[model samples]
Target: MAKLHLIKLSVGTETIESLRQWQAGKQTQTADGLPRHVTRMWPKRADELLDGGSIFWVFQGMVQCRQRLLRFDEVIGQDGIRRCAFVLDPAIIPTTNALKRPFQGWRYLQPADAPADLPAHRQTEDELPASLSAALADIGVL
Candidate 1:
């Protein structure tokens, strides 16, 4: 089966570097030192997600980067509720800037719909302004 993916808004993040810095903190990582994103709902298709899937991050209204989903761990809050912790690879891969609307939570992203990873040469280029990127994406230029 084709690998599945998830897309979530990187709230409060202004750039990909900011997101990398934020995740670098110890508190944002699992006990084993992997980055993680805790969520209220566990994915029903965990197997597919674990089959080389990634968590695509939406920064400033555009899909900017992704981290591979390594595993799901169950975590309980002090409030005594169970939640899913998406243990992620530490490597943050840059992607072609794809425009996305504001959303409340993560959504499933099919392989066909996910943005392509930026070529290695382009990944080193200065990041484009969100508006310009969005306009390019809107015109299918991204």
Candidate 2:
């Protein structure tokens, strides 16, 4: 099974607006798409999840990629309240060696089940981390 990682990333003002617009669009498209419970839980959970020393997974396509640490912040939302946001720093890296297969889509893995002692270097959202390189070495990702 794919490991999950929670990443702390700051959503820019533009990104937040875009997300809101996307959510609005989705709401119009299908009533049963995203549940209200999930939406309500996201903010509070995000606050807790972004606490210090959190780890998250990174992904390229459908495959697991690297991991990152979460750095929390508060940004002004459209409503003008300082709200939670996160910043990502690499915990792992994705590379040809790390991935047993090539990626075909664009999505990231959540940080929850990522391996501890993951290589610290060579991990990046756009590049592989050293830890991931070592992990891949074991699995022949190279």
Best model per TM-score: 1
lDDT of 1 by residue, 42-97 (tens): 99999999999999999878999999999999999999999999999999999988
TM-score for predicted model 1 compared with the true structure: 0.95
What's each prediction's TM-score? 0.95, 0.31
What is the model-wide C-alpha lDDT for candidate 1?
A: 0.91
Tens digit per residue, CA lDDT, model 2, 1-142: 2333343221221222233343355422223343111111133344444444343222321133333335444445566666433334422233233222333222233444333342547343343454655576567644
Regions of model 2 farther than 4 Å from truth: 1-57, 62-70, 78-83, 90-112, 116-142
Please state the error at residue 103 of candidate 2 in Å: 15
Instruction: Give RMSD to native, each candidate.
Output: 1.2, 12.4
